[model samples]
Target: MKFFLWVALVVFFSGCNNSEKENTEINGDIVYDMYKPSEMSILMNEMYDYNLKIKQEILEGKTPVNFPTNFLNIYTAELSEFKSRNETFQAYSSLFVENQKEICNTDAHSDISERYNNAINLCISCHKTECTGPIPKIKKLLIN
Candidate 1:
């Protein structure tokens, strides 16, 4: 009876381990170093959504009165494998943020649309190099 109990426990644990591994696979291939973004990813998604909405307003020929500001200062959870990716993102993001600042600080409406488009371009460039999976979604943010 004790021998049977030991065997059952071993079987259960082994099954659990295998399931965990299987859950991480895609198309029957094991993925390596998958970065699971933390809850902070939600905030990041929200930021992107906000930008998309603004872009839509621009496409309709309406100038947005308020622009996003200081979003990069907001902290988000980082993946270890994404250190280089994050750096690249930050570099491009700085340009986006600066453009936003300039738009907000000045009364000049002449180049506001152009600057907004430029910001989206930077976003696309970074995503193209680091993580191309979201290219489709990012492209949707383009104003023109």
Candidate 2:
């Protein structure tokens, strides 16, 4: 009876340890997961839309341009959605500073440029640490 009890205790403790180690797991099998593929596709679509807006903003010489009205709103919404998904998928903690923080407070072109650069850098930095496969495209986004 004592030997059986000891074995049970050992098994219970091992199970507890395993659960703790895998507590904050991510769905790494995103390729196979239906939701992940759709989510990634949506995020890419947003990025493409955002790229066009970025060009327009550069031409207009403004940060968060509202010329087309609702453009900024949609862009921000899409960016936030993608970022939220990325954060949720990351198992470990990561630091992603806001690149748009200063744009709202000021309307300076240079400040916008700086904020944009920082934001792109944040993407590059996170990708470098998490997914090195997209490093080339990410690096190209930075202001050289």
Candidate 3:
């Protein structure tokens, strides 16, 4: 009986530890799963800030010396992986990526500003569908 009790306690404690590693326990009965942002989400927000600067330069009639091309390279791969999981996200990402590439390739101020406006529109379209909280800030990217 003593040996059996020791084995049971060891097994129970090990199982408890493993469960704790996977989830947070609340009220001894409820578990609230934790959510970590995907790599693409973090990269997207960073690029949004950079693109906002590009918008500002356009507004001031100043050409940007640097365009954030690396953002496209890094996020595209992650977006591909994420796309396999969520079709809606994939569709919006495709629109955003294509215009962003055009923005980088544009050299003439007239063309660059037009392409940047198009890219900002894509951002607005996507956010309107899934994440509406950023709509006001995104509107700031518009030329008008």
Candidate 4:
């Protein structure tokens, strides 16, 4: 009787593990990481790196490279749907759409400065509503 009880408990726990695995790979999508404060911070770091690369391009007298590519790839790659909410990353992404034109166009060098400032501003704005305390770093990204 005791042996049978132990077997049943093991079976129940094993089934739970299987379900958890299923949730991780939902509908062919691999949920790498969900949108949270930590993940967004990392995504923001990618944006900073992209900004540096764009600066290099400007120094060499070339067009602005695709900043969105670097930012979005890292952001999306780390996003997964939460239990109910869509994802906090959407906030950053929503603001990104407005800057897409400037971000993708090398011809927008003169415009890129404002666009860069706007991008940093939006990052702070959204993070304020979602995750505050990173405003200092975000503000530093804005052009003087």
TM-score of each: 0.58, 0.44, 0.59, 0.51
For model 1, residues 30-144, the per-residue Cα lDDT tens digits are 4433334434354457668877777777677766766654365533445323243466666766776666555444576667668776777776776666545456777777666
Kindly list the per-residue Cα lDDT of model 3 for residues 27-138, writing each as its tens digit. 7843434334456556766877888777877778766665566665543545312235367767877778787767766454557678888988998887776656557777
lDDT of 4 by residue, 26-108 (tens): 68854432223335346666676776566555455566654455455544554222323246657566666557446556555
Which candidate gets the maximum lDDT versus the true structure? 3
Comparing 2 and 3 on TM-score, the stronger one = 3
Candidate 3 C-alpha error for residue 96, in Å: 0.9
**Model 2 residue 129 lDDT?**
52
lDDT of 4 at 70: 49
| Candidate 4 global TM-score | 0.51
Model with the higher TM-score, candidate 1 or 3 = 3
Candidate 4, which segments miss by more than 4 Å at Cα? 1-40, 52-63, 68-70, 73-91, 97-101, 107-110
Ranking of predictions according to lDDT: 3, 1, 4, 2
Candidate 4 or 3, higher lDDT? 3
Assess each prediction's global lDDT (C-alpha) against the native. 0.57, 0.44, 0.64, 0.53
Candidate 3 residue spans exceeding 4 A from truth = 1-25, 28-37, 65-67, 73-84, 107-110
1 or 2: which has the higher lDDT? Answer: 1
Q: RMSD per prediction, one decimal?
A: 11.1, 14.2, 12.2, 12.3
The candidate maximizing TM-score is: 3
The pairs that clash in candidate 3 are: none
